[model samples]
Target: MIKFAFLIALVAVAVPSPAAAQGASGFSVVNQTGLNMTNLTIRRFGTQGWKALGNAPSPGGRGSVQFSDPDCAFDIQATLEGVGTVVWNGVNLCEVKTVILNRNASGAIWVDYE
Candidate 1:
């Protein structure tokens, strides 16, 4: 019986669990230039307005900005970082800008765009 229990435990440990859903959505921005940016702001869907993510004084700096909701999803309007704001949905909790994720959503989390 003890051996069987041990075997079951081993099997459970070996199996991988499903990925956790985003608790709070956000973006991580890295300054990759020689100039400093001011009044950096980030906004998500269902929010009143843009929330200040962070500010960088110089290039090669990194910052993180979080959304109000863990499950909150948003459409990026006027990103101002890239060429233009692109529509995105189903962002995850605590996810930041540096990491690119698929906006298309399914059940609880956003999946990678195909």
Candidate 2:
């Protein structure tokens, strides 16, 4: 009967907690600029702190980054060579706007804040 008890304990411990069931969200970015760009960096702002989710060279000329936070409360920052943009998920920000890209060129980055 000891083996049966041990199996029951193991199964209980193996279950995932509610808090640990969080997942990442996927987002996309499009470069509307006629010129091709490179060196794309993505950032996610959280209660803990801001962190870089991922970075890659824009193969599509346009850049795309996914936010990997299930409970995302993040802004996005995209940097290409010497230009960058900061985006939030809201209409009204303290000083920064959500859809504003620092670069004068044309391009759009899509973000899904879960």
Candidate 3:
């Protein structure tokens, strides 16, 4: 009985806490496009009213921004200055720790996950 109790105690000690068990709840956006990005906003999956990046109207090339997303899932939308917009639907932010916005071979906006 004592051996069993000791084994249970060891197992309990090995268990991870809630905070430690939590996955990635934040993300960073990397602007690889040569032009600035406008109206960069992100919202919880299926939720309304996208939250803007900041006061800036547009972000320049190679610029990056980080934001908190406790829910770990989101829908991102942004526009390229003087160009069309780029939208990422149903993104799992936890699985994608970083998002890189660039241009594809066809000259269209491409979204990459890192």
lDDT of each: 0.46, 0.43, 0.68
Q: Give the poorly placed runs of model 1, Cα more than 4 Å off.
A: 1-20, 23-27, 45-48, 64-68, 72-114
| Winner of 2 and 3 under TM-score | 3
Candidate 3 Cα errors over 4 Å, as ranges? 1-26, 55-60, 64-66, 95-97, 105-109
Write the residue-wise lDDT of candidate 3 on 1-114 in tens digits. Answer: 999999999999999767655544655677767766678887788889788865323343343455654566677787876776777777666656677766654666667788
Worst lDDT run of 10 residues, candidate 3, spans 55-64
Ranking by TM-score: 3, 1, 2
TM-score of decoy 1: 0.38
- Write one digit per residue (lDDT tens) for candidate 2, span 43-76: 3453434456355434334334444444434554
Provide the RMSD of all predictions against the true structure, rounded to 1 decimal. Answer: 9.5, 10.4, 4.6
TM-scores for every candidate against the unseen true structure:
0.38, 0.35, 0.59
lDDT of 2 at 98: 26
- Clash count, candidate 3: 0
Residue-level lDDT of model 1, residues 20-94, one tens digit each, is: 344454456454433344555545666667655555334556666554554445543223232333333444334
